[model samples]
Each structure stands twice: as structure tokens, then as C-alpha cells.
Target: MKEKKWLRTVLSFASECRMKMILSVICAMISVAGGIVPYIGVYQVIILFLDGKPMTNGIVFRASILFWAFICLAGYITKLVFYAISTMLAHFSAYSILENMRNRMADRLMKAPLGTVLDQPVGKLKSVIVDRVETIELPLAHLIPEGISNLLLPIGVFAYLMFIDWRMALAAVVTVPVSAVMMAFGMRTFNKKYAEYMESSNYVNSVIVEYVEGIEVIKAFNQSTTSYEKFQKAIASFKDYTLHWFRSTWKLMNFNGAVLPSTLLGTMPMGMVLYINGSLSVAELTMCLILSLGIVAPLTSFTVFVNDVKAIEYAVKDADDFLNLKELENQSEQITLHRFDIEFDNVSFSYDADKADSPNYKENSALCDVNLKLSQGTFAALVGPSGSGKSTVARLIARFWDVGRGKIKIGGVNIKKLPLAQLADMVSFVTQDNFLFNCSLMENIRLGNPKASDEEVIKAAKAACCDEFIRNLDNGYNTTAGEAGGKLSGGEKQRIAIARAILKNAPIVILDEATAFTDPENEDKLQKSIASLTKGKTLLVIAHRLSTIKNADRIIVMEKGRIAKTGTHKELLKGCSLYKDMWEAHIGAKQWAAGSEKGAVKQYA
Candidate 1:
């Protein structure tokens, strides 16, 4: 039953290209039968013409030779043609199965919660998606039709050898039991060894990806050598483990290969013994030898994939586990949100390690008995120190992850009742680290409202105060964003992210350090754009700089994982000690930055 698990996974995908696979199997069978016809025809020709008691003239023998030659030629051609067709069909079905399986996995990952997707390393997920999935092509493309047909054909041939002479039949298969034992030893621990190999490969892949992605930081800190050393060491470790894995199985695999295809060793000698004992005639012994030789070829091909089943099985199970990952609860049907007020009711939350996607997050309690509400059209600002639960509050309202305990509702309805798409359509989240696909600036902005026209995209860009710089570029709005919007500077990326939010025009917006990257010169313009856009919508700002949110309708001060106070900024400054201290710190940082700028100007002069 354990051995059948991987095969079941492969066959489960067979429904995708069942008809093609069936045809491939049929062609494979015909190919096998075509192979045997020539050997049988030779046996017949020798039996009829060279029987010890008979003699035929040269004219008749010449005619017989020509007939047999033509028959053998025809049988050989059929084998080649059918085998070609069978392989072509197998490849088509195999690729189709692979494509369908990949798409399904991708869809599953997308539907899975952000935290669930983040729980696994990028390298392991990619290893499963790209490398592990590719391994299935071995069984699907080469092994299924060919393996099954070859296996079945040998059984039928062996049965015929049994009918010919039972003792010769026993001799012919003596190698099979020995081969089976070798196969058992080879496969006994294959699943565990293969898993270790994959883990090392995944670790190497993750290190490579991390090294490349963090190259900017690595150089900035002058840790290039250290980073490169780490990457090389990971790669070296993976190589050593792979070589060790192969070395461990080297002997058993060789034994199986060498012994499995030597049926003639037993049959040839046994047939000679039988002939001497007079229990078998020349015709009977000749047929047994011919059949034994024929049987070994297909058996040899079949052994190549016997142990490989272990690896493919493990791959299929891993993929199945990923596809079954937990997802955030969401309704299937869309429900209208009559109001846009954001409400968190006694929400206590923690980032569970088992379900966390972000490396920076932990099992630490993020929010403790938090209760807050932002009315429709209210401008709310959250002020807190690092890890004070400001961002977690905003994220829960946006349903990044469901609160561990308590209800987060938007418009008087629990967020879990809202369909994922409908909820997504209603919220626009802009953060310090915003993502932009590799496409034109126009398209990137249009992503917020995919149906927005060219004119609308430009209007949003102008509103975000990025229009002037965009027009100064060679392609204006048509220029590509590059990978993750890498072509743009930090300030430029922020403006584009703001432009996207403006284009979306969602009723509720959460801005977590949205102005962190903008230059002082453009900060005012960016604020004006945000102020204009938030005129009648609920706005939540998670700000580090207290001055930016001083004019907000409501300011909520956070300490640890709970709210310290809530009031207008002026009231909080007057009444709250922590808020006042934070304000003083913010002022000093600004003055320090101004003094540094002035010192630089004096030095230049």
C-alpha cells in the first residue's frame, strides 16, 4: 500500500490526457509484439528447413530465405514506426499533465493566505514547483506507457516459454528472483535519501536567491566577502551530500542492472542439458532459447524505472501537501458593504509561527484586547514605537490574517463574511515596501483599477505628484517599471504606489509609513495629494513622524500591544506622557537632520 501511494498520484493526473495515454499504451503494446514476431519467425524458419531428418534442394531453400527475410524486414519496420508514434504520444500527454498540474499548484498558492504562503521558504516552494514537479516527466512521459506495456509483454512471453518446456521456463527466470532481492535493497530507504537530497538542494537554492536579492545590502555593509563565503559553503555542502547519496546506492543499482538481463546464462545451459537428456527436441530447445533472449530486453528497460517510483512518489506527496495548505476564511458570495467604518472588537492577535509568512513576525502577541473604530470619512492616525501593534491593527482590518480572538468588521458585518475579492476591491493598502510588476508605469497604476483608461491613469499620476518626473523620462507613462519597479528611486516608487491607490479610489485606505521614502521637497506635494484623496473616505495612517499626523481628526497612541490613549493630536500632546515624549523625540530628529544639511552646505561653500 505504501508503495502504491506515488503511483496513485501519477494516475490521478491521467484523467487530464486519458485518451492520448491510452493510445500511447496501445502503440507500445503493438511495438512489443512487433519485436517478438521476427524472433518467432526465425525460429520457425530454422525448424522447417534445418530439422535433422529432412533435406531440401538449393532452389527451394533460396526461395525460403527470401520469404523469411521479407517477413523479418516487415516486422522490424512496424516496430520502429509504432514505437516512434508511441513515444510522440507519450511526450504530448506527459507535457499536458505537467502543465495542468503546475497551473493547479499555482492557483492553490494564490488562493492560500499570505501567511500560509510565507510560512515556507521561497527555495523549498520553488524546488517543489520547478524541480520536483519536473521529475514526474520521467514516469509520465517514459515510464507509464512503455513501462506497463513492456512489463505485461514479458509476462505473456514467459507464459509461452512455460507451455514450451516447464523446466527450461524455470531456468529462464532464475535471474529474476535475484534481481528482485537487489531491487528491494536499493529501494528500502530510497524515500528517506531522496528527501535529504531535496532538502540540501532547497537550502542551496534559498541561499543563492537570498544572496542575489540582498546584494544591495551586502555591498552597502561591506559584507560581500562574508555573504559570498556563506553562499559557496551552502553550495559545497549540497554537492557533498548529493555525491554521498549516489555513492551509497551505487553497488545495489549496479547489481540489479547486471543480473536482471542475463536470462540467457541460465537458459542456454539448461536447454543443452535438456537436449542431451532427450526430453527436448532441436525445435523445442531452439524456441525456448529464442524466447528467453527476447524476454530479457523488455525486462532490462523496465528495471530502469522500478526504484525511481520511490522518488516520484515522494515528489507527488509533497506537491499534494502544498496544494492543501490552509487558507484564510472568506465567503464565496459577494455581499454589499453599506458602510465603510473600520471596527476592531476586543481583538487579541499573535503571529503564529506555524502559520506565519513573514520572517520578521513571531509568536509574540501582536495585539491585546484592542478595541477601536474609525467612522466613515474619518482621518485616523496611529502613533507608536516599533512593534507597538500599529501595523498589526491596520493589517487585521484589511484581513491580512484573521484576529486570533475577536471580530474585525467593516460596515457592521464581520470581515470573514465578505468574499475575498469583494473585500480586496474595497481596500487600498500602501506601505513603505510597495511592489510593482515589470510593466509600463501606466499599467502599474492601472493595476489598482484594471478597467481605468489611459486618461484616468495619467490623472492619478498627476494627483500623486509623479507626473512631471514621468514626462521628463524618455517613455513617460509608457516606460517599464523594471523588476519590482527597480528602475525608480525610493521616492519615485512611493509616488507611484500612491498613484495606484488614487486610481483604485477604494473607500478605505491604510497607509503604513507611506511617506518614509519621499524627499522633503516632494513630501508636501505627496501630502496634498493624499489629503485631497482622503476627503470623504476612511483613512488610517501608521506614522513614525508625529508632525505628519498632527492635524488628523483622531490620533490613537499605542504602547506595547494595547492602546495608550485616543484623542486629537493637541489633546494627546497635552494629556499623554508617552505621546509628549514621542513628539519631543520627533522634533529633535528633524532638527538634527536640518543641522547636518546646513553643515554640508557650509563645507561645500
Candidate 2:
């Protein structure tokens, strides 16, 4: 049943190039026929040379040597030409279909929720997209149409031999069962082994990436020995597993290889015996030997594709798994909106919503029975300890993940009713660890609003206080971010991210630790700029520094995934013990920094 399903899936991909694949198969069959016809001519020519009589039904070779040679040469040329045409057609169609599958996978990801993409590891996803997808090319390009012909050409030769003598034909294929047993032994463990191999490869890739990304921290902490050992261990594990997997199958494979092409082993002796008897002629025995040798190459070629069948099945199944990930459902793109107020109506959520659909899913709620509202054009602040669901609240507002229960409305309509693109346009989320592409600063900022002009990008950058440092750089706005903004300081990346959000100018701006990297020197200016940019817009700023949001119209205190308090900063301090303790801690930390700075100044003086 699984084999049948795999064929259906492969045929579905082939249906896109059905005509091309059909033509290619036809050409391959013709190529094989062309090869067989020349073998017949060669056989007749041999008989003419030895028996002094025409072995063919006509006076073909006896008439002229040059004509027979020309016929053989033409036959070989036709075989070569049609084989080349078939290969070209097969490869062209295969790659085209592969490209389409990749595009469809990309589309599926775009339609999926952000949480769906985030939950998967970077290495695993990369493996599926780049490595696993490429594996399909082997079977699609070579094994489908060409492999069919490879199988048929040998079968055709065997049929002709059977017509000549059933005993010789049986002898020709006598070693097949032994070779088959060897092949089966070698490949019996391939599926499970290959899956493990892929898993190890993906782990190595992920470990390498992690090592490279954290190299600076590794050096700074002087933990090079341990970290490098971890890195080496991952690679070593993958290498050891791969070598063992290969070693386990290598001996049987060698035996199979030794036996598979030995078609002449039985045919030669059997034909000689038959010739000794009155049953076989010298010409017929010679023809049988020659034709049996001819099938060795085809038989070898056909068996080569047997291993590929498993690889193709695994590759196609992995690709299909990624492409079939459940998409986030939305009602329509044309959701009606009157205002941009954000509302959480008895909302609850969990990060593992993907697994939560299962009956065995445990309840690990990130937020539960929490309800809040941000009126239009209000400046609200979300404050909490680490993992208190502050970021989750902001993420929910941006529709990064759907609420497991209850409704989140934007402008009186459920946010789930808005398509991803429309929802993205409504919210501008700027986080501390926002990604920067390896491109010019102008282009990076313009990613927020792709159609934004150069001048507008500069304006937004200036507004976000990125213009001064940007201008001092060698290329100014033209400077490349250099691999996740490695060329700039953390503060600079933050400012650029804010500039992107500013350029977007969405009505709902959620700054999730957007100012975490800003130094004390520029924090006030950046805050002012942010305040100015978000004027008359619904602003939800999540911050650890309470001083920055002291003047916010509302300060929401979250504790253990529930709203503990909501008021102005002073009201919170007066009424909420948790808020009061957090404010006191913030002040103490600030005073400690001030004291340390003063002590350093005195020591320097």
C-alpha cells in the first residue's frame, strides 16, 4: 500500500510533465530497439563470415560488406541520438517539477502560522528544503523513464534468447537469484539506516551552525575546549554512524556486484554443451554468447536503480510532510474595521498548539483566562518578570500564533478573520533580536515597506536616530549589514530595526524590548523619537526598564500568565505589591549602576 501511495505521489508530480515524460519513455524504448536490431545484424554478419551462408532471411550482409557495416553504424548512431534526446527530456521535466514542488513548499510555509515555522529546528528545515528535495532528482530524472528502458532492454534481450533456446535463456539468468539475495541482504537495512544517517547529518549541521554563531561567546568565556569538543563530537558521531552504515552493507554489495553481471557464466558452458549435441548450431551458440554478454551492461544498469527507490521514497515523503503542514486558517482578507483598538477577550493560549490538537496533549498554557483592551491611540505598557507571558501577549496581538481559546479582535473584528498579509500591515513588531539581512542598510530598512523610496527610508532612519552613526560609516546607508548586522553594534541594529518599523508606519506598534540595547546616553532621545513616531497610534511597549514607561497611559502588570494589575505607573505602585516590588528593584539596579560609575570616575581621577 505504501509503495502504491509513493507511485501515486510520484505520478502526480510527473503529471505536470506528462507529455514530455511519455515522449521521453517512447524515445528510450526506440533507443533500446535500435540497439537490439544492430545486435541481430552483427549476428547475421558473424554467420555469414563462418557458415558461408546468409543467416538472416535476406541476402543482407552477403550482398555488400560496406552496406552491412553502414547499417550497423546507423543503428548505433540512432541509439545514441534517441538516448541523448530521452535523457534531455527526462532531466528537463524532472528539474522543472522539482522547482515547482519547492515553490509550493515555500507557499505552504508562508501560509502557515509563525509558530509552526519557529517550532521546527533550522537544520531540519534546511535539510528538507535543500538536501532532501535534491534527492528526488535522481529517481525523477534517471530512474523513472530511463530506468524503465534499462529494465526493458535486458528483458528484450532475454526474450530474444528465449525464442532462440529456452535452455540457453535459463542459463543466462541462472545467477540472478543469488545476486538478488545478495542485493536484498545489502538493502534490507537501508531504509532505517538512511533515516538515521539523515538525522545525524541534520544534527551535525545544526551543531556547526550553533558553534559558528556562538564563537564570540565561546572565546569570551574561555570555554573553547568544552564548546569545541561538543562541536567535534557532533561531527564525529555523524561520521562514525555513516561509516558503520556503509561498512555493514559493503560486503554483500560487493558480492552482488560480482555476481550480477556474470550473465555469461551459465550461457557459455550451456551453449557449448548444446553445440556438442545436435541441438545447437555454431552460429546460434555464438549468437547466444554474444547476446548474453550484451545484457550484462543493461542488467547492471537496471539493478543500480533498485537502491534509489528507497531514497526517492524517503525524499518524497519528507518533502510531502513539510508541504502538508497545516496552514493557519483565516476567514477572509476583506475584514471590516472601524478602529485599530487591540482587544483580548477572555483569551488563552499555548505555544505547543500544534501538538495540543492531539488527545494525548498536556495542558501547558502560556496564558489563561486573561483579558485586556488597548483603546485606539493609547500608549500602554506591558511589564512582567521573565516568562510571565508579556512577549506572548504582544505576539498574540501580532497574530504570530492563534489563541487556543477566546478571540483577539482588532477594530471590532476577530484578528483570525484577517489574512496574514493584512494582519502584518496592521501591526509593526520590533524586537530586540530582530534579524537583519546581509544587504545594504537602505535595502534592509526598506524590507519593512518594500516600495518605500530612498528618501523616505532616510527620513525614517533619521527619525529613529540611526542617521548620525549611519552617515559616519564608510558607505552610509549603502553599507551592508554583513551577516545579521555583524558590521554594526547591538544598539545600531536596534535603531535600524526601529527605523524599519517607523518606515512601515503601521497603526498598531508593539515594541517588544526594542530599546533594550540603547545606551543611557541615547535612550531618552530614542524613546522620544519612538513616542513621536507612535503618536495617535495604539502603542504597546514591553520593557524591563520601568522608568521609560512611567508616563504611559496604562501599565499592565502580568504575573504567571494572568493580569495581576492595570493602571498608571503610580497607581500600580500604590495598589499592586508585585508592581511595587518590581519598581523598587528597577530603582535599586539603576542606583547600583550610578554608584559603580561614580566609583570608577573617582578611581580614574
Candidate 3:
């Protein structure tokens, strides 16, 4: 069954470029024919000499030599021309197929539930899309055309040998079964070893990416060399596994290699015996030797593709798994919302749905039986300890993941009924880890509204308090973000993200700790900019700092995935213990900051 699936995968991918593949096969067949013609020419020359033909002036010998030369020349020319054409067509088709596959995978990811995509590690996904997809190109570009020609040439030569002397033909193939058994033994553990190798490779990739992203933290803590140990261990593990796998297969491979191409071992001895007994003529013996030798070369060429075939099979399976992942159930109907109000009713969720049978599943629930609502244009704040489901609630309103049970509605309509694009237009979500592409600042902001004018972008930047810092940069608005905004400060990146959200001008906005990294000096200006951008719009903010949302219309304090209390600042202070405790912490931090500033001034004086 597994082999069937692998074959189906190969056929399915090949079917995408069927016409080109067929043309390539035709060229391959012609090339095979060309390769076999020289052997037949040699056979004919030997036959004439054994038929008692005179060697006068060596006329017949010269004519035979010339005939063989002309046939070989023409055959090779045709072979080169057709083979080149075949490869060109295959490569074009391979690239075209890869492009289409990547686009389809991207589209699938867009439609997939956020939780599903997040569950997969970044390194695994990269391997599937970049490395695995690229593996298919080898088989498509080289294996199909060359493998077909090589197999056919050997088969053709073997058939002619059988016609001349059946016994010699049988003797030629006597070692084949033995070699096959050796190869099968070599591959007995290949699948398990390959899987282990892949796991090690993915671990190495993940650790490398983690190390690079966390380099700042590592350096700040003076632990750069110690932090690098994890990455080094991962690389070393991969190397050891790869070498072990190779070593396990080495002896069997050598045996198979030595025996599979030794077809002439049996044919020469058997033909010589037949000739001595007056059963096989000298010409027939010569024919058998030459043909048997021809067969070995093509057979040896075919064995070289065995490892490539295995790689292609594994690669296609990996890519297919990702492409077939389940997508979120989103409706195609586009509905117009009447209001920007949001509601969460009897909502419960867990990240462990796929791992429900595991022992760790019980602790994976992120939300449970939570209920809440926000009126249109209301500025609501969700305040909670870490892992209290504050961010989950904000993400649910944006349909990042469907609730495990119960329903979430926007404007009194089930959010699932709205088209994804339409729902996206209604909400602008800004999270702390904002990803910026490597492009100009102007272009990055424009991503919020692709059709927005330059003037509009500049206006949005000004409102987000990003204008001054952007202008101070060497290229102003045209400066590049430099790979995930690495060139900019944390506060600067946050402001740029806020600027993007502000430019979007959506009716609803969700901020998941958006100001967590901003400095106190920049916080006031950013808050004012946010007020202007979200004036009269429904805004939901998840804040760790109690001071930031003190003036919010309502504050919902969350504890253990449920709402502990909901009220205004004064009401919450009077009734909610969690709220009061958080407020006290915020005030104490502020006092500490004031004291530190005063001591610095006194020291300077």
C-alpha cells in the first residue's frame, strides 16, 4: 500500500507535465536505439569474416569500419540533439510545476486555521516548501529521461543475445537475482534511518534559527558561547546520524556494485564452452561477448538512480502532506455587518484537540466557557496575568481560530458566515511581534492598504508618531526595514506597526499588548495617536500594564481562562481584588522610576 501511494504521488506530479514527459520519453527511446546500433554493426562485421568472405585489399573490412563509423556518428548527433531538447522541456515543466505548487501551498496556508499553522514548527514548514519541493526537480529533470534510456538499452541488448544463444543469455543474467537480494538487504533499514536523519536535520535547522533570533538576548546576558552549545549539539547529532546511515549501507552497496555489472563473467565462459563443442560458432561467441558488455554499462547507470528515486519519493510525500492539511471552514457568502459590536458566547477552546489522547492534553486548554460582549464604539480593555486567555480572546474575535464549542459573532452575525477578506477588512489586529518585510518603510506601511496614496501613508505615520524618527533616518520614509525590522529599535518597530494598523482604518481594532515594548517617553504620544486613529471605532486592547487602560470605558479582569470581573476603573478598584493588586504594582513601578531619575540627577550635580 505504501509503495502504491508513492507511485501515485510520482504519477500525479508527472501528470502535471504529461505532454512534456511523453515527448521526453520518445526522445529517450530514440537515444536508446542509437546506443544499440553500434553493437549490431560490430556483430555484422564479425559474421562476414566467419562466412569465408575474402579479405582482398581488406575492402570488406574497410567498408564495415566506415559503416560502423557513420552509424555511430549519426546516432550520437541525434542522441545529443534530442536529449538536450528533452532536458529543456523537462526543466521548464519542473520549474512551472514548482511555481504553481508554491502558490497553491501559500493559498492553502492563508485559508488554514492559525492554530494549525502555528502547531507546525517554522523549520519543518521551510523544509517542506524549500528543500523538499526542490528535490522533485532532480527526478523530473534528469531521472525520467536518462533512466528510461538506460533501462531500454540494456533490455534490448539482452533480448538480442537471447536470440543468438539462449543458454548464454540465461548465464548473463545469473548474477542478477543475487545482486537484487544484496540491494534489498541494504535498503531494509533505509526508511527508518532516513526518517531519523530528517528529524535530526530539522532539529538543526530549528536550533540555528532560534539561536540567530535570540542572539541579542544571548549577548546581553554574556552567554553567547554557552547559548551556542545547543546549536552545536543539533548539528553534531545530524552529522552522526547521517554517517551512521551511510556506514550501514556501505558493505551491501559495494557487494551489489561489484556483482551487478559483472554479466560477462558468466556469458564469456559459457560461450567459450559452446564454441569448443561445435554448438556455437566463433561469430556468435563474439556477438555474445560484445552485447553482454554493452548490457553492463547501462545496468550500472540505472543503479545510480536508486538513491535519487528514494529521495524523490520522500520529498513528494512531505509536500503532499502539507498541501493537504485541513483548512478553516469559512463561508463564501459576503455579508454586510450592521455594527462593529463583538460577542463571545459560551466559548471554550483548547490547543490540544489533535493531541487529546496524550497525557499533557489536560493542561492545554487556553479558554473555557467564557462569555463576554462589547458594544459598538466601546473601548474595552482585557487585563490579565500571563496565560489568562487575554490574547486568545482578542485572536478569536479576528477568527484566527474557530472556538472549540459555542459561537462568536460580529454585528449579530456569526463570524464564520462572513467571507475571510470581508472579515479582514473590518478588523485591524496589531500584535507585539510585528513582522516587517525587507522593504522601504513607505512600502511596509502601504501593505495595510495597498491602494492608499503616499500622502495618506505619510498622514498615518504622523498620527502614529513615527514621522519624526523616520525622517531622521538617512533615507527618511524610503529607508528599508532590513529583515524583520532589525535595523530599527523595538519602540520604532512597534510604532511602525501601529502606523500600519492606523492606516488600515478598519471599523474594529484588536491590540494584543501592542505597547509592551514601548518606552515611557513614547507611550503618551503613541496613546494619543491611537486615540485619534480609533476615535468612534470599536477597540479591544489587551494590556499587561494597568496604567495604560485606566481610562478605558470598561475593563474585564481575567483569571484562569474566565472573566473574574468587568467594570470601569473606579468600579473595578472598589470591587475587583485582581484589578486593585495590578494597579498597586503599576503605581509602585512608577515610584521606582521617579526615584531612579532623581538619584541620577543628584549624582551628576
Q: Candidate 1, residues 1-605: lDDT per residue as tens digits?
A: 26677666666767868888888889988887777668766876876666532354666666777787778878888878888888888998878877777887888787776677878887778878888889888776877667866787787678778888888988999999998888777778876887787678768988999999899999999999999999999999998998998899889878877888888889989999999999888888888887887777778776567556656777787788776777777689898778999888988787774433444433456887889999998888999899999998988877887787788889999999998888888898999998889999999999989999999999999988889999999999999999999999888898899899889999998888987886777676777667655667888988887777887889999988899999987899899999999999988898877432111101000
Best by lDDT: 2
Report how far off residue 579 is in candidate 1 (Å). Answer: 1.6
Superposition error at 55 for model 3 (Å) = 5.4
**Candidate 3, 426: how far from true, in Å?**
1.3
RMSD of candidates 1 onward, in order: 5.3, 5.0, 5.0
Candidate 2 residues lying further than 4 Å off, grouped into runs, are 4-7, 10-15, 51-63, 185-251, 354-363, 594-605
> Candidate 2 residues 1-605, lDDT tens each?
26657667666766678888888999999888888878777776776777655455345554755566778888888888998989889998889778877888888887787888888877678878888889888777887567867788889989999988999999988888888777767667776787788678768988998898799999999999999999999988988998988888778877877887788899988988999987888888988988888777767775567667777777778788877888888656477577999889998788877655655433477887888999998888999999899999999998878888889999988888887788899898989897899999999999989999999999999888889989999998999999989998888898888889889999999889877777777665566557556867798989897877777889999988889999998899899999999999988898877432111101000
lDDT of each: 0.81, 0.82, 0.81
- What TM-score do all the candidates reach, one by one? 0.87, 0.88, 0.87
Candidate order by lDDT, decreasing, is 2, 1, 3
Model 2 residue 304 CA deviation (Å) reads: 3.1
* Model 1 alpha-carbon miss at residue 199, Å: 3.9
lDDT of each residue in 425-449, candidate 3, tens digit only = 9999988898898999999999999
Q: Which stretches of candidate 3 lie over 4 Å from their true place?
A: 10-16, 45-68, 196-248, 277-284, 354-364, 594-605
Global CA lDDT of candidate 1, please? 0.81
Clashing pairs in 3: none
